[model samples]
Target: MPELIGIARLAAESPSLLGKKRVEYMSLTTRSYLTRCNNPRMPFRWMINPYRGCEFGCKYCYARYTHEFMELRDADAFEKKIFVKSFGPRRFLGELRKLPVGESIAIGTATDPYQPAEALYGVTRAMWEQFARTAGFRIGLVTKSNLVTRDAGVIASASRRHAVTIVVTITTLARDLAGALEPLAPRPELRLRAIRTLARAGIRVSVNLAPVLPLINDSEASLDAVAKAAAEAGAVSLGANVVYLKDCAKSIFFPFLEAQFPALAGRYQERFRNNAFLRGAYPEMIRERVGRIRRKYGLDSSREAAEPELWPRDPQLTLFS
Candidate 1:
């Protein structure tokens, strides 16, 4: 177990609250709700994660190491112990005002904001209500849950004045494979239904076929099926990225592969042994595959960032421009 300090230590000291199946919800104090991202590779500069640990428990989740910061060494603790950030709408709105206008904000960068806990605790929905008051902001939300559709009204209200995009992440349409990969997340078919609901509400929707596993869900037929579904559901764009095996993720994922997919386990070990990312030919092939799928479905890889007419002009934002 790594040494725990600061916020992680505080959260560890906090008493556990509700227990559900394998996961336990723990409440923690949050001084701030938004974080500024300095990663140049990412499109968004600001991000908000309503929860610290995700309940989805995906095999390839790269965020398991986040538990290490909390002194929870057991890799499984990342999924078994969930922490809900103490939400303050007033404080969150203040933090939002600090962001420079035109900068993008991504919700659920580290955890699914609309995860199962959301049904018991409506934090994600509350945040959207706060967003409804702001204008001239760019917001992006990604989720694997159909629960997002429950807040479609708030999302539509926010979109009236801001550039909002809701991305539904669907790895594969195969029920058994999806069941094994994202055990607790909503089914692929349910996510598609949510996409259609949001699109009909006039909210920009997209489908993300991310963490495209090599031997599992990366087949041409599989990718085409997801792309076609997104298009038929009225998605405006499509995007995908191959799997990345970070150190924390590999610790759990490697064993999972051995048990579930013995045939491909050895290949995965060799491919990820020397590198966290697959480079050279494999990535190039995936990019070409994704591009072809997008074109086939008439989906754009990029979205226009123009400000909507309803956005309230802000003189302070001009300073950052």
Candidate 2:
């Protein structure tokens, strides 16, 4: 067996917290809460994930590569084995000081900060509770859960002092399709409701229609449906990008496609064979399609010369978007 070190070692030592259904939640201790993002292409300086694994179980989740660091290789383990990080207010405050003035810190980069674990462990809420006390910072959070609305008051308080952009990822409005793609996540309607709630509270909210699958939900009409829903729900912007499948994500996603969309499997394999990213006509087409939809909905991202651009973070990306 390969030797475990750093995070992998910590994960091995962490004790089990609870198990529900086929999922098991554990607690992980870290030296610090903020991870300095070293990717030069990344816009943010730092990233935060309150939990390591997500129970949302979206088959295409790219963050699944995170578990390999902890020596976890089970395909289902990424969804089933969740690790909640320990949080301390003083440590978080210290970490805040280490950041240079005016850089962005993104929450939920790797996992949904407000996933089911947040309701139980409250690590994400605790971090926001601290953000509520400070001012003049740029923070972004991305999630697919309505649970974020539960902390609406606190998030609002944090935003008053900082430039906070809350991104709610809703890939499709077709309820059954969404249920199939993200089996354990909240319904699409509920996520839209979350956008309305946050926008009503005066928080800037955006919609991300990510991983625009080839033949599945990539039609012009399908994209229009989501953009229309976003505008009606009071979102400030709608951004989308085609899905880029890394080897780690493909391990699970390709099988999922084969099982659920047999006809498209071979095509997907060929398209992604030589490159994880599709660089030519397909990508350009999606960009134009989504751009038209955004224009149709009158959606424009909130940008300021004095501040950093917050999200929809994928190169088209999430530490995360």
Candidate 3:
């Protein structure tokens, strides 16, 4: 007999009724919550995404390939067919304890935990509730939703046990451009407001200006506006990375470019045709640009390290102690 079930089989068997515009949630069982990241370049050792597939439908999203694992081949499926993981608090907390003490765990690395479906499921909120009782781990949460502000109290409660940093991704300070690129995400202004709120709550917050799409939002003035606003919002730092296009992303992004920016479409095709990442002076140029912006705003270039005093004193707080 064939295997009883797989992700694809389960996805087809049951798709939750909690639907949003052009998107649906499919609940799936998971044996683990924390996924180990072996990529040496990544600062974090483990990551957790409360959901699979993003509703934001960002044209340049690199995570779209994630759907392929479930046999969902359509490029748009990554956004429209979201998979909500079954949360097991006991199993999740057990996994957290298995991790090495002080290792970083980033939430929303693969999908926005605060996506619209979160309003109904509360998976992200539940996860934070668990963190509130734990300690000694470095936790980072990244999102593009203002909804994160709703959890300020939970975040603060968690910080009492663990070091937490909230990273809000703001690709461009321009409303129209952000609307076109990240069509379904919260507005730029709203995200900024969320940043300010989190900062005022005494949570260490940073702004991520990632996948700096060249010829789109890569101008010095654009970067400056974002850095300036981040500084004014009391952000601890600003981080950025030039856009890198993998085959999966190009499938969606290239068509988007043709429709939205016909003039620059050819150039992007040429730049990414041979390689996923741009080489030579381009990356260095952005680093220098970001460095200057960071200096201008008195912002650090890296995530803030947890203060020694913030580490809980209880022997049980540590994973190995």
Q: List the residue pairs that clash in candidate 3.
A: none
- Which candidate number maximizes lDDT? 1
Compared with the true structure, what per-residue lDDT tens digits does model 3 show for residues 108-199? 98799999889878889989988876667888899999999999999988776677889999999889899999999999999999999998
Error of 1 at 276 (Å): 1.0
Model 1 is weakest, by summed lDDT over 10 consecutive residues, at 312-321
In candidate 2, what are the lDDT values of residues 76-178, reduced to their tens digit? 7789999999889878877775555466888887899988988999999999888776555688898999999999999988776678888899999999999
TM-score of candidate 2 to 2 decimals: 0.93
Q: Predicted candidate 1: what Cα RMSD to the true structure?
A: 2.3
For model 3, the superposed segments whose C-alpha errors exceed 4 Å read 1-6, 308-321
Write candidate 1's Cα lDDT for 116-207 as tens digits.
88988888999998888777788899999999999999999988878999989999999889999999999999999999999999999989
lDDT of 3 at 100: 55
TM-score of 1: 0.95
Best by TM-score: 1
lDDT of each: 0.88, 0.85, 0.86
State each model's C-alpha RMSD to the native.
2.3, 5.5, 2.2
Clash pairs detected, candidate 2: 109-319, 109-320, 313-317, 314-317, 318-321
Name the lDDT value of residue 114 in candidate 3: 95
Which residues of candidate 2, in runs, are more than 4 Å off? Answer: 302-321
Candidate 2 whole-model C-alpha lDDT, 0 to 1 = 0.85
